[model samples]
Target: MDSTYDLMEVLNHIDPSELNYQDWINVGMALQHEGYSVDVWDRWSMNDRRYHAGDCEKKWRGFHGAGTPVTGGTIVQYARDQGWTPPYDPGTALDWNDTISTEGVVVDKNWVEGREVTEPRQWDPAKELIKYLETLFEAGENVGYVVKSWKKDEKYLPADKGAYGRTAGQLIELLTQCNGDIGGVLGDYDPEGGAWIRFNPMDGKGAKNDNVTDFKYALVESDSMEIEKQHAIIRELELPVACLVHSGGKSLHAIVRVDAVDYPEYRKRVDYLYEICKKNGLAIDTQNRNPSRLSRMPGVMRGGQKQFIVDTNIGKETWTEWKEWIESINDDLPDPESLDDVWNNLPDLAPILIDGILRQGHKMLIAGPSKAGKSFLQIEMCIAIAEGKKWLNWACSQGKVMYVNLELDRASCLHRFKDVYQALGWEPKNLKNIEIWNLRGKSRPMDKLAPMLIRRAAKKNYIAIIIDPIYKVITGDENSADQMSNFCNQFDKVCTELGVAVIYCHHHSKGSQGGKKSMDRASGSGVFARDPDALIDLIELDTTEELMKQQENKAVCDACRQYLDAHFKWEDDLSQDDLCSSFQMLNYCKEKLDKWQMEALERNIEAAKAKIKSMTAWRIEGTLREFSKFDPVNLWFDYPLHTLDQSGVLGDIQPDAEQAPWQRGSAKNKKNAKNRKIDRKTALEEAIEGSNFGEKPSVNEVAEYLGVSERTVRDRVKEHGGYTIEDGLIQKSDEKQDTGKPD
Candidate 1:
């Protein structure tokens, strides 16, 4: 109501021609606020602004003659309701209803009333592709069209034979007819993975021939993506697309227009776009790079879902514009020349933890047959590494270790750890660096467990994480290559991102014992062994049987020697049957030989029995057969044995083969050596701290205090440097300024 009054007052005084665009908008808003509908304003404002030049004059007039106001007929009332009335006689402006008269205006309302709007038709890809080619070449150029289609079951139907000498419109018609019956029409001459694409059409017979086309767009397939996200990416990239289709079931295919001079340029542009999409979390099917890769017809039923059109913001762009878009996004790809500086870069292998057996930023597997005491052995090794002790006879690098027991209950795992702890003479609380996580009851597969464990690993920074029995966490069939590969990649992702070593335990396959190759003995797909940086197989050995066989051979030697002496008559007890009863003499020799054989066999057996008895007294039992990636030769060591002895511990037992240097050390001796180094460092620190600065002590005094050579004391003091030697005596420096030097 207020706007109506205001608009009316303005029309009475102000000329519409005097207003700028903003003033016109203000007037329109006022009229709308006052219930002069948008339809009325639009109807009046449809043509040039000049048309409303006389409207304000017609709506209101003041003092036609002295002291008199003249108003028009009902036209004025109608116009007032519309917030403005035009300047025209009632008979001319209105029919009986006081509405605008179109009698003489010759309004063309039904020019095409019964027909469809014949402007540019909706973008039919089949037609547009032909048009693009024709434009790329010239008029009367040999522009070709190749139409391929698929049957209902996705079986390739016969392609429309090469149609030559066709205009863009004619080709479109041909494709339209094919699309009507079959699933869709493909413009690609060949729609296979490595199709040789060109602009020239080949008869289905000559499709493989190399005929180059002047222009082609790269087809990209991105599946299982959000439409909104796709739109956002397109908007961001501003790519000039030939056509885009929602090609059924979470898949979208795009034909991106590329302005490339040759095949190399085309491929480069396509690869760049693909990488960009990949970097932005778009699951682009990288295999869809060929120019002849087919795309779904825009308006067709594909598996009951429509391969409908998506508005490519720049779909109809000219070659020049498309080229600009390509060049803008195509960064220079990495080349061998660009990597020249990296040619001489040295390999920086991660730090070794147990020489060749273990290292940082890698994964290892320790597998064995059932009841080989592998779990016990692995637990012992883990405890040794965690507590800065040696494992078996091998040196261990000390750090925090986590035991993820996925195959054993908490109580059982604790019991095993307790056994190893008691054997090592360590209190439970002393295992501060070791953590056991019981994941036995939980059924979280690797897919679900990887992220959680990765987060935990990042937080804990454990030097090595031992997942006992890897099968518990693996989700799919281990025999399935696809499943296992994906699972292994996921695991690798975790280890690489976390920068921690992962050690897992696994079981040997049934009847795989005594396999010559240590890896062949592992269960599941070869990936289980192939994927790890290291593999350790703890096998059982038959040391007792072999030792007994050796003893039996020695008995045979003794028996032969005794029989030879008796038969040759070197011993007086072997009389020739008391002076030659020929049968008796033969019986006597045979009897003597038999007696010696039996007696020697018994004696040697008793000796073997005695050795077994001695071994029992020394607590030596079964032996363990060991094989690893670190060494090719198999080794056998005394089992149920303690490696913690500090002295010449290997004196009591024997090895089936020579030991490697890494496997030759005693755990306690290594520990004691490490302790001595620590003690020396500690004593030097004490001597320095206890010395009076006013009476600073010399290196000799420090050496005497720690019971070491002056050179050793001086080296130790220098290694822990925080002081200076002034006049042969060490004194703390008084420097106040921080130079940011390494100490």
Candidate 2:
């Protein structure tokens, strides 16, 4: 019996309670015939309620060999009836010691009818040899053959290594020249002992594994089975046989095509071929595993039997096709399920990972242009998930997270995380939940990294895996749809294997992104945007000077209030309006505080000014699959932290590329025109107030301060309509003015 399959595993699949008495006894008989201990049967039978503890031992002792003994195939068939399918994947690379399953059995031995073999009526020895050579080898390749045999333990064996340096073309020419006399071309052979020929092409040297030029055909001969049964099983299995020849003994030599590239591959493929053949009931002769092993030659006589070709090209056209077909038949893919069967008892949906954003075991992409703080946003999300805090406006589930930092050095990446926590004013309470894998210079392609990541994170129970700046590990051309689709599947593999959400960041394409949809802004093929369950795109907002001034004033006022809270008691003396104005706050602090305290306040105000100048505004737009589309969120990237814009200043700002071409110019012109008028009015007022310390300013002085000519300044004062210009002097008008405010 072939031990490639585990009979115990097959027996486990059969429920004893589902089997009748005769069928249950047949299982025991099969196990006993296959040489298993009686204990195996007793343990398996314990599953049935009617099983007696000592019944198996008594039955085992009486199990003598019968005329037609039951075999392990009976248990395999019973398992199949019980809905037990074998687990196997043909596409997976097979190791040398891996157990081969019988999931793809192509032939049923009990029902397979024999395929009869017949002798040729008018035998042509030279023609038969020519056909065999032409089918198995190229014209320029070397062929090894032996005609002499020696008796070894009552069996005829090749006397020595045969002639090695004869090309197939040369032999064919010689055989054709010597018609009707086979011995004239080479040497005479015993009529009772058949000639032997190596199936694979040789390298004009001794016939050994190393001397084989192309690792082509492998011999699949089984002498233990009847000739007719072997023939039937070989064809039914669809072995890619180049030539099927009768050995003129008890077996047929199937020269199955392996088409391996080298020696190691040849060995692996031959092992797989033999295992498949054995599983399908053709017990392969294990000795014929070497590439240069010999098989019976056609047109030869062996013990009164004539060796001849039975068939050619009997199965699949190539080795790869046959292997794929076998794998497809026995793949571990689940069977199609009917919707009606599961409609009432539907499975629960995956739990939310980021509320309103994504689910556990899903994927999300964060895309933006360079220096848009995309990586910082991902790190913030990682922290939020670790602490069960809100990331931006969405709440996150708390758990362990892995931050795969492929674009930063170890120290920089660690420091950045610490710096972000400090900037956000969050304590390091859940530091243990975060795992950082910094692969700055050691990053591999996503396909290669996914397996290593899975192995390390198998039992870690991570809720999310965040990869920062995925361009470092991108596998193929970003522009190719198919290639990028394959590249994105690596994320799917990681998600499926670890059962965690995968979040990564990508950069947007060049040029303004205001016009494109959030999904279209991500650089590269659309697959990058569409493949993820949620896509968050960050585009820069055009910050106006008025908004910047408002931010700076707010920053200075907040800094003053923090300084006063730490240093002095100012709340009792200052009103809300005084604290809100930067000018008024500075005057009050300088008047009431000492020099040292005022110096400290000056430094804080300077830092606040710088922070406001360095700030960049962004708008986050989302495309979600599991939830409804959300309103675009506004954010201020204040260096190391992204704070939500609570002031509503960015609410009216529009992305440069997001607007339609016709609407963009007109809308922008209207907004810019109104802002310009306000800016001109403010500049004139400030200039007039500063000239000569609170006196009506001269037209020349105002123009110089405003960086314009006197005529431009006069026109601006006239346009203001709240101020009058006369005699090279500017003065405020007393009429009830518009004040640039809406009713």
lDDT (tens digit, per residue) of candidate 1 on 1-743: 54113334334533333233443454555454454544444444434334445444343232123242222222233334333544432333322222221111111211212111121346354443444444333444343333444454433443543334544445455665774432243334323211112332322233332333533566666543455455455544555665555654455566676767777877897787775554444446676676544445444443444445554435437445644544544433344554566668956877666654677767877777776666776788788788776665567788888888888888988987877788678656547788888877774777667766665566676777877877888878888777888877766766776787877878888862543366766788888778777777655443443444443444444444455565565445545434233233334545655765656645754664464433311111211212243322232222333342233222334342333445446634666876887786687668876654446788777877778887877687676666656556766665323445433
Q: Among these predicted structures, which one has the highest TM-score?
A: 2
Residue pairs with colliding backbones in model 2 are: 514-657, 514-658, 515-657, 515-658
**What lDDT score is found at residue 35 in candidate 2?**
86
Would you estimate the TM-scores of all the predictions? 0.37, 0.62
Task: Point to the candidate with the largest lDDT.
Answer: 2
RMSD of 2: 14.8
Q: For candidate 2, write residues 1-743 as lDDT tens digits.
A: 63645888888777776455677789889999998999999999998766888999999888889998998767876776556766842222222223324466667765778788887888998888888999988899999988999887557999888887999999899888888577776578887787899999999978888899999999998765567878888988999999999888878999999999999999999998987876676766687898989889998889998899988888999999999998888765779999999999999999999999999999999999999988889989989998899999999999999999988889989999999999878888999999998888877788778877876788899999999889998988999999999999889989987899999999999987888899998999999989999999999998877789999999999988898889777698988898889999888888878999999899999999999999999999999999999999999999888999998889988776656788778977979999888898898788889975888788889888888998998888889888875555677777335556431
- In model 2, which runs have C-alpha deviations exceeding 4 angstroms? 1-186, 189-195, 198-238, 242-254, 258-321, 327-332, 659-743
Prediction 1 global C-alpha lDDT: 0.54
Relative to the true structure, how large is the alpha-carbon lDDT of every model? 0.54, 0.86
Candidate 2 clashes: the total is 4
Show model 1 residue runs off by greater than 4 Å. 1-232, 235-347, 427-430, 475-486, 543-743
